[model samples]
Target: MSANRYPLEVDVAIVGSGPTSAAYARILSELAPEARIAMFEVGPSISNPPGAHVKNIGDPAARAAAQRASEGPGAGAATVNSPGEVKAGTRQARPGTFLLTEGYAADGEDGLPVAAMSSNVGGMGAHWTGACPRPGGAERIGFLDDLDALLAEAERLLGVTTQAFEQAPLPQKVRELLAAQVDQDRVAEYRVQPMPLAVHRRPEGQLVWSGADVVMGEATRNNENFTLFDNSLVRRVLTDGAAASGVELSDQLTGQQYQVAARCVVVGADALRTPQLLWASGIRPEALGRYLNDQAQVVFASRLRGVEASQGAGAPGAGLSEQSGVSWVPYTDEEPFHGQIMQLDASPVPLADDDPVVPGSIVGLGLFCAKDLSAQDRVEFDDQVPDFYGMPSMRIHYRLSEADHQVIERAKQQIVRLGHAVGDPLDERPFVMPPGSSLHYQGTTRMGTADDGTSVCSPDSEVWQVPGLFVAGNGVIPTATACNPTLTSVALAVRGARRIAEKLNNSLLMSKSDNRMSE
Candidate 1:
């Protein structure tokens, strides 16, 4: 697109093309219909529909190829490593995903050695597992004036549905068994049910996972005011005094730079890069990259007590199609960690090279513990070292507190109980993954009630001192949550985008009044 023409000015300049940015694009374009929106993505479009989830690809080889296209900066190449060789560490080593340390070979170098991210039009939305569970108990954000309304709106945008696995017989049984285990723990208040997913299930049993494309709504096709620029990286957020003026972006394919002026700038470039870009622009807030936190994950597998190991629906190597499992135990104050139980066609845990999971013989359980947020844990940038993209090189500083460890221990105990309720634990039993394994990192550019040193943004996701500058994605979430953060992140971005639209509308009114007075 840049080969033909470039946008010199836009009403809104979105820095990343992901779920959060999609939320911003959706609300801003609809409310501020006259506002021009230009969304810049650093990675090329890997799928046919620019922002479609790669999981929608039917062919295994093609899906793997798509993932190869979006591998993180650290991923050198997708090698055909055996399951034992590509051990699921802090983050699961799926065919398409790789750890942040993959290219560096710097395991144990940081608190979050396995932290990983993909680069593409949909951002993490393209690779996410599509879990869209609602936050409960301590997981909910407190500073918001009204959170329920925002969450509902976000769900609508993502096309969240419980029907993803409604017809699958295995999930109901797994849910009932997990619910029984919860009852035994005397925390039945925390319901156990099929995971709420961002998916559209067709009548013929095809599952369509929602990525940024779903939230973009009509903006992806019909809106003339919206434009998505793939393979473009936002270098800096341009500001005039305290107001955000626009952004300086460069084509990743070509080294050409283009300045797109705008009334507002919203950076939803994931948790890690969002702060890096803000720091590069010298918007160095006291909490620019502080309060970096992620949920501690403990995963285990077990063979079902009653069900026989048969080639089931979507099992790998089975003559059937595939459908990923989505079910969990809702987070509760009593049980600080959330329990995720799923009946994958294959076992999630592989105790050995010939792990029964390969034979589709067992169910998998994952426990995610929300960490204790602290200022000491941070992501520091080095000016001397420019990263692969020429941005300030990033180093994550993270540590699980003693309390966080105890939370993990409690989670292990709960998972054991749940494991026993449905099936016997596999030989590997329960184990804690390395830091950042949860991959749901949050709170770097966190939103607070005030512009205090503790937070980078205000309650509305606007940068504290930078009036027209805003931040979104997992970074802006201030809460320590156990549920997947996508739904919540989108909700907050929607709130912020709405505020942006309101301001744009007000500015237009003021301009109209001035013209009438001159007449």
Candidate 2:
């Protein structure tokens, strides 16, 4: 859509422009074409095609700059200080990947110190590793009646495919060796396949990575009802008698604030910040930022014995060497951890020595175990303090339970066994990373079926008691997942989109009814 005037009312106002926000906006535009929608992104649009994946940029310098841009404003500063006070160095999966933690994280509480976010037009969608595995067995949300349908839609929008490296030799070898390591007793639900990735392979032998742009479709272009406002920071969700009425936003570049009315508000501003926004909006609940979960991640690298690296084979210029193999160990009752193995000819997983690329004869291995969810693990805000963005300050308090430690131990054993099957494990490589290192923080605004104190939002992603206010993104994931949460989070947003469409459809019906009554 051509840009619309400011301060105008919109049917729906979406915060954050990652996969979750994109999913909400896209589905709403499709299901309710007449509903006027506006998406507000806090950071500047970094890409020329705005929201295109950094991997899509061929030049090394351009890609690196875009990645850093996604890292948020503090990353460009001479002295970085997003966490309010800095003690430990800011950590991230890669450059242009993570926004520094704003306010305070329980640096002593293990995982909270490293929990981070990304701020850009596309958010984390522009800089993800593209691992899009589906939940299995217990990892699937049992309450979702339309689980399969939602997942299918999310996968379609992400362009997820198992055949991304169907022709790569290294992946086939890794799958074979990894399969041999899995206990024969649990083979039924624990077999392997090529990694599911949100990527498209063109006939020209180039691969285009999925980002918020891919998910947004033409909503930002041809849809007259949809408008994306970049460099606008939403500070609060305006409410009127238990219902969302609008949002208060400020221009990030100019510091000019605007009061834009919205019939409904949906916040998907990553996990940590989503809850922060809710707190800033004075919608705090007992469960608003409780039950914080970051899956215990164990990373290691191993030398490949028989497999040869196809340097330019599957992923082209992208870091993915051979498509990941058996992207899951399958979260089952007996083995609750998930395993991801990648042949890193030019690897992206950071190892102690490898940095970016593992030797051609090496493969990177990772195991993620679901954390035991507890009320004690949480991220709270101090109304008195202000964050880097001048909002309510955040303080995360998290720790691993005894059961969590047991899970981590078992994950270590599992990865070591699988490592032996592939090659020799590198010294100091096969070890558990600090908490939050995985960057898969979840469950802050977790959903439940009711307005229970244990959940901040309803099962459909609407905040409890706030009828028109909703929350999405990883924060709303109620589960302690073993796989990457992007696909599942996007799927959950699909569910929310359907609910929002119904509300919009009813509003239109009521207008017609009122007109007839007046006549």
Q: Which ten residues in a row have the lowest lDDT in candidate 1?
A: 314-323
lDDT of 2 by residue, 26-47 (tens): 8998888899999999887888
Error of 2 at 438 (Å): 1.0
What is the C-alpha local distance difference test score of each model? 0.78, 0.78
RMSD in order of candidates? 3.3, 3.9
TM-score of 1: 0.91
Among the numbered candidates, top lDDT falls to: 1
**Residue 75, candidate 1: how far off, in angstroms?**
4.8
Off by over 4 Å in 2: 1-5, 77-93, 98-108, 187-189, 308-326, 345-347, 351-360, 516-519
lDDT of each residue in 1-519, candidate 1, tens digit only? 447346889989999999999899889878888889999988878886778888777787887678887875645555423334434432345444555543222344348766777788888888776778889978898778689999999999999887766665667767778776675565544678777778775467555677888888775457888888888989999999988999988888778888889989999998989999999998999999999888988877777666654535434331122333567788888889887675554222232343434333366788899889899888888787888888888887777778988998899888888878777776445777767767798999999988779999988899999989999999999989998999999999989999999999999999999999999
